[model samples]
Every structure is written in C-alpha cells, then in structure tokens.
Target chain A: MNLDFSFFTLNIISNFIIKGLLFSIKLTLVTLVCGLIIGTMIAMMRLSKFKILNYPALGYVVLIRSLPFVMVILWVFILIPLVIGKSIGSENSAYITYIVFESAFYSEIMRSGIQSVKKEQMQAGYAVGLTYFQSMRYIILPQAFRNMLPVILTQTIVLFQDTSLVYAIGAYDLLKGFEIVSKNFNRPVEAYLIAAVVYFIICFSLSYGVKLTQRKVQIAK
Target chain B: MHYTFNWSFFFKSIGGKETYLTWLVTAWEWTLTISFFGFLVAFILGAIVGIFRTTNNKYLVTFGNIWTEIFRNIPLLVQIFLWYHVIPHFIPIINKAPRIVLVVMAIGLFTSSRVSENFKSGIQSLSIAQKHAGLALGLNTLQLYWYALLPQAIRIIIPTLTSEAMNIIKNSSVAFAISIAELTMFAMQAQEETARGIEIYLVVSVLYFISAFAVNLISQFIEHKIKIPNQTFVKQ
Candidate 1:
C-alpha cells in the first residue's frame, strides 16, 4: 500500500486537531465543575442520616452506573428534546450528558472520601458548637477533599478520555475530528495515530499531575 | 408534541413474526460469544504480559508497557474500525479469513489492555514472601507462576476481571458499527424500520442492563466463594 503525506492535508488535519482539542478541554473542564457540584450534593445525600435523602442518591447511582454512557448520551440527545419541548444544541446536550453520566461515579468517589474521614473529625467540630452541616463543611470536607484529590484527578483523566464518545452525537470532538480526517484523506493510520498521541499526552500529564499533587499533600501532612 | 404510544407496533418491532426475534436471539448469541472469546484471549495474554510487567525482565516489561499504552489510550470504537477497515488491507492472508474471526480478534485485542492492567496489579499486590516460598520449594519460573503466583493473582483479580467483562459486553456494541449484528445494531435497524427510536433504544438499554447486572452478581458470588484471607493489605 502506497502512503501519501501532503502538507496541505496535514495543515487541515492540524487545524481540526486544534479545534477538537479545545472542544475536549472545554467539555472536560465543564464536566469536572458541574459533576463535582452535583456529585458533592449526591454524596451528601448518600451520607445523610435520613433514608428519604439517601434513597434518591442511591437510586441515581444505580441507574447511572448501570446504563452505558452511549445510551445515556442517546437518551439526552433524543429524549430530552422530546420531553422538554425545545431543541438543545448538540454541544450543550453532549456536555449535559457527560455531567449526568459522570456525577454518579464522582459522587461514589466523594462519598468514599467522606466516609474515610474518621467520625472524630466530625465530632470534634460539633463539640465546638458547630452545626452538623457546618462541621461537615469545615472539618470533614477539607480533609476528605485533600485525600480524594488524586482519585478526583484520575477521574478527570477518565472524563477527558471519555469525551471522545461525544463523536456519536456529532460533537466534533477529538475522535470525530480524526474520523473526518481519516475518511477524507483515506489515511486511517496517520489520523488515528495523531489522535491517539494527543489523547495519551493529555491523560499522561493528568496522571503525572496527580502524582505531584499527591506528594504535595503528603508533604503537608 | 408527544408521539402516540403504538403498543402493537412496538411489540411487533421487537417480537414480530419476521426476523425480529431471530435477530434478537442471534444478536444475544453473538454478544455472549464474542464476550466469552474475548475474555479468554485477554485472560491468557493478560496473564503472561501481566506477569512480565512485574518481572525484572526489562524487555518484557517494556513490551507490556508499550502494549498497554497503545491499546488503552485509543478509543475502542476507533480501534475496532481500524482493525476491520484498515488492517485487512495491510495483511493479505488474514484478510482472506472470514469476517467473524477478524471481528473476534479485533475485540480480543482491544479488550486485552484492561485485562493486563488488572492482572498486573493483582500480581503486584501479592507479598514477596509468596515468591520466596515458591523458590524454596525448588519451583522454576514457570512452575512458580503456575503453582503459586497465578492462583493468588486470580483470586485478587476476579472482581476487577468481572468489571472488565461487563466492559467487554459494552465495548462489543462498537462491533455493531462494523455490521457485526450485535444487540445495539439490532436495535438500530429495528428503530429504522419501525420509526420508534425511543422504545427500541429503551428495550436495548434494559437488555444490556440486565445482562451486565447478571454478570456482576454472578462474579460477586464467585468472589465471595474464593475469598482469600488476609489479602486486605492492598487497599484500593
């Protein structure tokens, strides 16, 4: 098989690659923020003393964890529009789906973090006349957050990698950009190799960052 | 603007007198068949590579790392497409083999990275004393891994392997893009014919959910049976 590498074609692929990387970065950051907020709330509910609060969170985790990410994305893209009586843009819909699917796993991660904190931490805060919520906010959360940083970062890497699935819904993410290039130029190996290298760089950097943060946390401790 | 619920149409779509049931059954069969074969390939290859990963053999360890990096970084769908669309054009002999074998090989190769990681971590978690004991008994490298290291690693890795199996099932959906006639493709075609996209997808989701749940539950049960005492030192 003869392989042709054209400068003009490479330029086009590079342009699309930059756009795809930007979109992936935006998706990853937005999902991390939204997922953290929603996941924190769900973690709180899961750890609540009341059954009413806990069950809903439990239900959410089970449902989300069981459903495939692609199915969830399809559900949001197709069903949400039907249900809400309005058209959601493809990018926004994809972002929403990512957050929704990610929060379940993140919440479980956060819940474990919270549970790993000793009961005395909460008790110590309460003994100083802090409210239950205040104690959790001040004492439990700070420590748990520190302990969970590496895991959270690892999840962020996973989320970053998973952003490629947005290609299913025409989101023009990294994988989709590669697909377009490969299809257009009939150079599947080159296109895929470029995309794979970019992904590996991002994920490997995130993992390395996690290691650094972990060391800093340990040193501080 | 809700679409009317056509119960008969939905039922006929999935349970029709035509090839709907046949397609569903065949799809289920193919999904399970692919998953089992893929898991077997991954398990055997992963075990060897996983052992190599923890070994002092620099060449073996480097090979394992490269394999993992290449496979794990790429999306399964892209890899499946590459294997199906691109690899055949490169290799003439394998290209002549039937499509089913090629698809199975693709799935197996794609899933093996995860299996290798799981197995490597499992082996790493075992204490050095175990290896010492194996050597004390005059066991060779192969014999030590077979008689001592692998048995313990297998127990440690079962839960992880179970999750990997579920992942294999999920990844098998990508095979649909290559016209493998798995469950997801079945749903897609059925939806196109019936124009009931929502219901068809819902059914497909439920099917996947139930199968995944069943696999998880069975694995959990097996894990409980093979519970290794004092193995809690390697906390996740």
Candidate 2:
C-alpha cells in the first residue's frame, strides 16, 4: 500500500532506461529488415508450384506460428551455441531467434501480399518478355508491399512488445533496465509501474500511427 | 566443439520419482490449466467490455476503449511481472493469492483486450436494423442484446475467437517466466540437469503445437458441423 518514487531521477532514466530502450529499438529494426528478407524468400517458396518448394515453407510457417515466442527466445539462446559449436552471445542469439521466428509471421503476410497482386499483372509481365523473378521484382512486389504495409506495421508493434521477452535470457532490454532499477532502489512498485506506463505509451502511440496508416492505405486502394 | 544428440534422456528419471517426460507432461497440465481458467476470465470480461465499447453511452465507450488500449498495449510479460512482483505489494490480500491465480488474472486481462476487440467488431458488423427492430419489438436493452445480438455476434466471431483460444494456450507459456513450472520451466530445469537442451526444447514445443493445433482442428470441426447451408457470412 505504500510506495516511493524519489529514486527515479533523470540520471537513472538516462543511464539505464534509455540505454535499454536503444537496444530494444535496435533489435526491432534489425529483426524487421532481416525477417522481411528471409520471409520474402519463404513466401516465394510457399507460392511456388512444386511441392519441394512449397511444403517446407508451409511446414515452417505452421510450426513456428504454433509455438510461443518465449520458447523460441529461450531455445535459441540455449541450444544454438551447442548446435553450432560456438558461443554467439545472448544478444546475437536473440537477433537470430527473432529473425527466424518473425520470418514465419512475415512470410504469411508476404504470401497474402503477393497473392493480392492481380494474376493478370504477372501475365502482363510475361507478355512483356520479363522473367518471373524480374516481373516479381519490378511489378507485383511493389503493389503487394503497398497493400500489406499496414499489416506489417501492425506486426512490428507486436514485435516491439515482444522484445521485452529477452529479459528472460538475461539480456539488457527495456524491462531489464526496470528490473535493475527495482533491484537497486528496492522499489519494485515504482520500477514496474513505470515500465508498464512506458510500454503502454509507446505501443499506444504506435497503434495510433497504425490506425492512421490503415486509413491512408484504404484510401489509396 | 562437437555434440551428439541424445534421444534417450526421456527414459531416465531426472528427479528419481518421475521421468523427465513425466515432468514435461505435468508442465503441460499446468499450461492447459492456465489456458482454461484464463480463457474463462477473458471470455466473460471481454464480452462485457466489448458490449460496453459498442453501447450507446459515451462514458462506457470511453472506459471500454481505455481498458482495451491499456491491456492491449502493455506487453503481457510486463503485466506478468507487475502481477507477480508489484500488485501484491499494493493489494495486501493479493500477497496471499496463489501464483496460479495471479498469473491467470494477468493472462486473462491481457487477452481480454483482443477478445473484446473481436466481440466489438462482431457486434458492429451486424445490421443496425437488428437493434432498431428489437427496440421496436419492445425489448429492453439487456433483452435486446441477449436475445437479438449476442447469439448472432457469437456466431459471427467463432473463427476469430478460435485464434484467441489458441492464443491463450500460447500466452500461458509466459506463466513459466513467473516460475510457474510450466512446459518452458521444465525445459530449462531438465536441460540444466541433462545437457540435451535441444531435445527438451523441441519436445516441449511439439507438445505446445499439438495442443494448439488440436484446438484449431476442434474449432474447425465445430465450424463445419454448425454451418448454415449456403450462408457465406463466415470465412472459409
């Protein structure tokens, strides 16, 4: 019932919270780029006509989607080093894990985006004598990406929220910063309260942008 | 560095009383328990809050939006930490509450936002004339919703809610972060005791997939069984 806030100063905020925030942001951006790349490849695989190209991609998206993100994080952090015969560090493992895990989600989004491009567009590309990859690169991808940008952005918001999970692997994420402050100041209440508020503010603001983007995307369509 | 995969770790008793496989099964039971109870809370509260958001009253609508945004925006893990660490400090009685109870509450509150969003869209998607017709028929607000709205809205949202149901199962994994001894906890502990980290995590993930996929199949079965012939209102 009793709480104190005097321990929370700008110095502590800058030293711990801001540092952790930068890492979280870095993780999100890095994973978004890498995930989209791998995910696009997977999406193309799934969209291919041959079973060799398709089944593995579908299996991947299904399998990865089914497991919890926490399992993926912990599993990546713990098992990858043993498998690969070297220590990649928790942060690197985290980056790898998010890319692998998020690729499944992004691949689905990518599949839908690619499918949304009219079949006639691809035919038109063929008529123009462009190869399939060339047409995909030049024409369909642009429209597909435009169609699914809002969805990808929405997924990023989820990614931003998910970065807090690295705290379990003992990484210095935003939540980890709060944990340290709580441990240092002996004020779990203030530390966690501030954490919740900060997370809410960032996500809520981002969601407002998502809503705006949805409107714009709809209008553009 | 070299490693050989040990597929036989499940046979040996890690704790002397039970095999590591048994420990994982027990954790699976914990996960299902959290998902089941958490779904109960999420469904009831989310339905109510969803109703609030869609109501004619401005204050209720605002309160509902705030509730949805607050719960939805905050990471469930952060909320779990607050529930596990902070809430007990403020509410003295919650200190005595079971960890299972608090974890369930956290998951429930976290997921209710999504469920509420589903329900809000479900209700809003219905024809406005349904509401007008119910009022014209002299049904009060409660009767109008209960008789004229909820049944149809529920029907409309079965698929979305199916994902939400699976989501509760997935999200219940966060309970392990609070040391709930769930599937993830068993994976970590069993790995520490036995160096077969990959096998343990793989086995645990498969268990999660089986349950979530089972839910998916069952919902699909129900969706198939309950189809109104030629009604294209539901998604394929």
Report how far off residue A122 is in candidate 1 (Å): 0.8
Candidate 1 yields a Cα-based lDDT of 0.80
Model 1 clash pairs are none
Per-candidate RMSD, Å: 2.9, 2.0
Q: Give me the TM-scores of chain B across the candidates.
A: 0.89, 0.93
Query: Stretches of candidate 1 above 4 Å error?
Result: A7-10, B1-4, B10-17, B97-103, B224-236
TM-score of chain B of 1: 0.89
TM-scores, one per candidate: 0.91, 0.95
Off by over 4 Å in 2: B1-3, B11-16, B232-236
lDDT of 2 at B182: 88
Q: Which ten residues in a row have the lowest lDDT in candidate 1 chain B?
A: B7-16
Q: What's the true lDDT of residue B162 in model 1?
A: 93
lDDT tens digits, residue span B1-236, model 1: 57776535543544446556666778778877877787788777777777889888899999998887677666666666667666666676766876657667776776788789988898889888888989999999999989888888888789889988887777666666567777777776777787777877877888888888889999999988878776663535
Candidate 1 structure quality by residue, lDDT tens digits, A1-221: 65455623668866777788788889999999999889988999999989999999999999888776777887788777788898788799998899999999889989999998999988899899999889988899888888898899888887888787776677888788777778877777666656666777767767778889999988987
Task: Give a tens-digit lDDT track for model 2, residues A1-221.
Answer: 66788889999999999988998999999999999989999999999999999999999998888889988888788767777878888888889999999999999999999999999999999999999999999999888888999999989999999999887687888999999999998888889999999999999999999899989999998
TM-score of 1: 0.91
Q: lDDT per model, in order?
A: 0.80, 0.90
